[model samples]
Target: MKKSISVLAATLFLLIMVSSASAARFSIGGFGGLNLPIAQDDASSGALFGAKGRILLLPFLGLEPNFCFAKYGGKDVDDVRGKSYTQEGGDITSFGADLVFGSMSSMGKMRVYGLAGLNSNTYKREKLEDESGLGVAFGTGFEFFPQEMLSLEIRAKYHAIKVGDGGKVHLEFSGGLNYYFGTE
Candidate 1:
């Protein structure tokens, strides 16, 4: 895990250094939405919030660094004897970076994009040991620019994380606003 994080940091640093020379635009945004656990019996749908920053490296490619916090809803489980018990939900805090590719042109008011990224996630829950793992995410979204310096965006992403011998998977749908800095 340490080695992987080091490599990721180095690669991001290199990309930023190379792209900074020609980067034309930058933006920062915050989003909030629903987080739905997929095929999981111990968890239910919850809420997620995050912040992200975008650096345009080319006309159709950009880099985004992001942080997110998500909650899992508690579930009611039935025991072997038909007794019911409550399974408490957990929380995940993630930090990651994404490569965004799409049509980002000034000629249109709307831009569509696809993104893939990797992240480090920390999981915390009651009665279980806390753990950290690596996660992967891929998604697609669109941005609508209603003004020269502002954009309204909506996205849907699939996120998966490795846990102790198993894994957790979820889908996130979010909406946000971005404020652009420099020429768009």
Candidate 2:
């Protein structure tokens, strides 16, 4: 945990310093979202949340790297005849990157954009087994500005986590805050 915190802090500090000196286009931000899982023969839909940081490469475009922590809520059903079955809600952890294509107002106020990314997910079950899978995702969202240096956004993504047997599809929704450092 200490190592993760240190990495986050260092990255934020670097972003602040770079954004403060360079064009206003450079900024850093974090986000959290909910996850919904599909096609888990033993599990139900659940919630997911995450955070990210971005560096603007152009006035209207940027590269974002993100980390997401998610949980799937589910229940199991059993048949009679003295037999018991297990159904469970699982927890997932994911990490990935997104190439963000969006446009902000000329004054750096409100913005709207789309994103595509590659992600990996790990699923955990109690007293059972764990699985890891790779996924592709795409989503879109809008950011609203209340201050020149800060804004809020809501985004969503569709994910396909695996191919072939026991594959799953997931949809997630999230919201976050962003800070713009300089001028455009």
Best by TM-score: 1
Tens-place lDDT per residue, model 1, 1-184, is 7887787788878988987898878899999999999999999989999999999988888999899999999999988588998788898999889999998645488999999999888889998888888899999999998988899999999999988778999999999999998885
Give the distance in Å from residue 41's predicted Cα in candidate 1 to where it truly belongs. 0.9
Per residue, candidate 2 scores C-alpha lDDT tens digits across 1-184 of 3354455456545654664464446556777767777655566667666767776756666667678887777666667477766567778787766667877434656678999876666767788677777667899988888987888989888877763255767788888888776566
lDDT of 2 at 19: 47
lDDT of 2 at 167: 70
Q: List clashing residue pairs in candidate 1.
A: none
Give the count of colliding residue pairs in each prediction. 0, 4
How good is model 1 by TM-score? 0.94
TM-score of each: 0.94, 0.74
Lowest-lDDT window of 10 residues in candidate 2? 1-10
